[model samples]
Target: MKLEALAVYEQPLKWFALGLGVCSTVCVVQGWQLAAMLFSLPFCLIWMYSGWLRTEPQLKYINMLFSVLYVYGIGRYFWLQA
Candidate 1:
């Protein structure tokens, strides 16, 4: 798809991903099953890939920052178990 189209779709996907990440965090904090850990992957993918499609420089930078932070938090969640 075109970058513009991707950028358009990115908003809803980002929201969904954020929701999933929040759910994953809740599950993790509550001592839930490890299966919930997998949910963060999709969140990270959507956030990072969507950031790549952003055309506006300012928005792209913001996206990159948020995406990196989200991915890092998710990554640390897993690493903390090790």
Candidate 2:
């Protein structure tokens, strides 16, 4: 795919990421750790990618950290389920 195509989708992806962040927040407020992590994993990933594309170190690293944490949380959730 061309970079132009990716550029076209950037705004939409950011909006979707925002929606995911809000959903994650709601899940947290509702005391749903698993669901929150599920939503947040994608949210963090999207923002991390966006940060990388935009050359924003702080945003990228912070989201990258959260992404790792969320992945670990999700993995642990399944690990314990097994």
lDDT of each: 0.68, 0.88
TM-score, candidate 1, is: 0.55
TM-score between candidate 2 and the true structure = 0.89
For residues 1-82, could you state the per-residue lDDT of candidate 1 as single tens digits? 6656666677788789889988988888887645355676566567657656754456556656765665676578779977
Segments of candidate 2 deviating more than 4 angstroms = 1-5
Off by over 4 Å in 1: 2-4, 55-82
Instruction: For candidate 2, write residues 4-76 as lDDT tens digits.
Output: 4576678888999989989989999999999999999988888887887788999999999998998999999
* lDDT accuracy of residue 36 in candidate 2: 99
lDDT of 1 at 19: 93
Q: Which residue window of length 10 is worst by lDDT in model 1?
A: 54-63
How do all models score by TM-score?
0.55, 0.89
